[model samples]
Target chain A: MSEDLRERFPEAEWIDSHDQDVVRIAPDQLLEFGNVVHEAGFEVLADVTAVDWYRTRTPRFDVVVNLLSMQHRRRLRILVGVPDGDPVVPSLVPIWPGANFGEREVYDMFGITFDGHPDLTRILMPDDWEGYPLRKDFEVGAVPVQFKASHQVN
Target chain B: MTDKTIDDPEIEEVDLWVSGTEEAEWDVYSTDEGAQKMRLEETGARLTEQLGSVVTDDYDLDDIITEDERMIINMGPQHPSTHGVLRLQLELEGEMIRRSKCVIGYLHTGMEKTAETLTFLQGPTNVTRMDYLAPLHNELCFSLAVERLLDIEVPPRAEVIRILMTELNRIASHLVAMATNGMDIGALSIMTYGFREREQILAFFEKTTGLRLNHNYIRPGGVAADLPPGWRADVSDICDTITGRLTDYEDMLKENPIWVGRTRGVGVITAEECRAYGITGPTLRSAGVPWDLRKAFPYSGIENYEFEVPVGEHGDVYDRYRVRIEEIIQSVGIVRQAADAMPKGDFRIDDRKVTPPPRHRIDESMEALIHHFKIFTEGFRVPAGETYVAIESPRGELGCYLVADGTGKPWRMHTRAPSFYNLQALPIMMADSVVADTIATIASLDPVMGDVDR
Candidate 1:
């Protein structure tokens, strides 16, 4: 499967495989590459999520997908970069209905936009929710901390 | 109409409709399973059955009404049976439920969003809290995914420990399911027995991981600590107690007629639907599907163990209960085998970045102290790549989809929570039943809101 990914997506890069998700490609190929992977065998949507780089990352947003193919028993990971300014990527909802809430999650967290998602509104937070809370730059003081004043879990 | 709770047995609004004239009233839906046709009562209190199962042939004429009305009602943010903080909008026929649409997101804590801010090593701490009942399984999946990204192998001792803790946690989680499901079913004492056994395992977790609940013991390279003194005996004690207690639970309710009536043929989900919905773990096994990740993918040296995947013959709620009971016995066996084969070696990988130094060395050497300090503070970095690791967790296949940008923190963290896939079948199961059956159906799904809402 790794060799097949390399051969098919020659322009795309295969970076690593964590547990089962073989990570490949970049931000530029997020949509097309995802379509290609869907065509391969991965039928389930799995999940779509993001992580913040604070400042060290190149594009600042790491977009990811977990795809499972029950027929082949293989899982694929697709990761893409979203630059700071636009933070936009095409939605995979047209292909998978499960991506509905997950894509909205990315939008609400890292301020990433899912271009063509049917309903890209907030799912977790309030409809009038402010700035993305999951961004590296987003401050955590929007809500008061009352759990503890002295001890932090970390 | 949008998202309402479909409750009540009396069909007033949906069944009968009265127009401009009070005399020209037509009945819409009946509670009968096979009665077909229309009933025009001046009052819109009852409907004819073409889609429902309430017997309408012997309709009581005592409560005849002169007026007709319909209503759409919403239930829950406080209702626990919706599974989480799920909201449902129902279209009603008087007291009879007509249609229901669900609204979720009342319990979402944004854990997936928060995972990106912390380092990859810090990811497990965040993920485990999502599914409180199955925390160890959460940590295992995330750590394994990270290890796979680094392409590093953990020591034999570490692998054994991981398998031991994870299988035990699976049993513990299933116990919570049995306990709460029993409570929902009115078998109150069964809950206490389940919790009693669960506490024994929780004590073992506290012994090794310091924290009892979210023990991030299963790190990328290996476990956080070596096997503590008397760890083997402690685990064996719990397993033995659980083995004995399980039979007692069977004696309490297995043959009881009330227990049989509630679950025998209720919530019958066929194996084909289980496949279509992509359900896993006990739920799928209960539906007669053979698709466990341990048997199919066999990660973290699960191939080394001698255990059988217990499956249910019927796709009913009763079969699901039996499958979980059998799984507890099997998990006990796996934990015992792993403990018997525990190796005398290092508990983590040799890589300094992923694994910390020996405890004694920190007191004697400056390099070891510095490494410990750095590991505790900045954490370790992984090669820029993405990975998704799926393990057979108690509820189902708990998989961690991680994207690492060659930094100490993760780029993106996505959890493939079983509740999400398993909950898809709720509408199918609850459609033909009475409102009272709602409690049983939700309990049978055995979902944790944290897993669902996250």
Candidate 2:
């Protein structure tokens, strides 16, 4: 089914979802997620999600998409590669504006940014918050204070 | 507040020191209003050399706010529309904000630190707690990251089930955003409707995963179980019901003059600044950037499916609402497809390295029982390497970076949360906008504190 849709929509490429058995796509192809096949009639944005590769050669996170078209009655997928130094993939706000908040969340919890997104700020934590909690190695609290308790607390 | 004796907890106030030549004196109080209190003069240029950014890159304090007449107002760590414990120190000239400094960490839970000490596969079970509303999405992102390092392939059925569960959770997560955004604008009924729909989704989750919120169902190499009996029918029913309620939510908020007036022209940030600041998701969409991770990188079984990426005219609250509302319809369609085309196979990989033997095997086979015991106690070893994986979570990009030194326990782990990065651009978005619009702007972003401060 996915192959037929790809053949139907010449602008798309097929991505292997490892052995998970679903076809995936790349981030640059994000705009064509559902609309390219709109002529064939798929109008749903089933999911916009990501995955983190803790042991990648570059140690970066990969963003993935799972799209559904109710009109054409089909499905599609996409993938984005983000660097560890700056895990920033372009925000899909302009394509599927619904992604605005979800992408912001990916930034907040994981610290990977959605580039070109407007209003990038702390939605959950304070604006000056530090650390991305979702990263596999993110420290939960301030590093343990080294010295003994300075004094007694009330 | 730190542990101290008898003395009043001295708040580390901002931009208030006049610099007494001989005395290291600071007012230790918030500024009057809207005054951008830079760290240079107050901390003094001498301190930068003493102890500041070791990697300084021309952060000109002079280029910081020059206007002296601005008044300062602190919004949060306790103020509304901050989403969760965010504290914004805003410099305002009456209603116009001149400069803004954000103060965070009041809600930090140290979730990442905990991950480092735990076994690798157990990591996903913990991360789901951070972004509580979108638990499955969080689990999927973290699980895939570990799988990448191990270079393992999950079973086909497991992958499809994960896609179905996480997508349903995505709709539920978006509903929370919608509900809270409405509550911020005093549209109480919308919150009820939003949560009302979310409740059904949660109920479905309980049926499959046995938990409502932070379910540890999506594990490395596969899921915890096959879909429960009648899961398809339950999920289908949910999709159908939500389809009807979504219209009610639209009627309540979409294009309503008050909502439009408050959200449409409020908190405008153009695409250029957005890119420069490293932003993404709906906020980026509002600015006219059409990038999305789903179309960019298809993982699990997403590539086999089809869907839409809804764009907006203006990067504003109104446009965001339209996008999300349309997305709910999209989510319904995705669920429908998964139910209609879900493949059949073992839910988890055959490798005992990831999962323990089935309970039945434990009774007759000594190896199976021993393997189960070992997995529960020692966890499986992973290749000595580091890897990072990112997923397009409800709040943008959720990523995990892990380091393994040929041990079950991860040597180091890091999460690249989209919330922290996106939150940096709030000043640019809310600076010139009125205080009233700030609420709308934040609501549109729909940030969650657990994920933000995890």
| Number of the predicted model whose DockQ against the real structure is largest | 1
Model 2 residue runs over 4 Å out of place are A1-154, B1-69
**lDDT of candidate 2 over A25-102, digit per residue (tens):** 455555555456434443333334455567754446766544444334344555566678767677665544435445
In order, the first chain's TM-score in every candidate is 0.84, 0.67
lDDT of 1: 0.74
Q: Write the per-residue lDDT of candidate 1 for residues B1-454, one digit (tens) a residue.
A: 5444466545355656555444435333232221111222212212221111122122232233333553456666678655567665544456654434345667887787678777777888898898888888899999988888888899999999999999889889889888888888899999898898899899899998987799988888888888789998998898889988888999987998998889887766666555544566787898776668998788889999998888887777888888889899999999999999999998888888887788899999999999999997888888887666788888887888777878787766778888766665554455445556667767777887788777
Docking class of 2: incorrect
lDDT of 2: 0.68
- Which lDDT tens digits does candidate 2 get at residues B83-137? 8887776656567655565655567766666776788668877898888888898
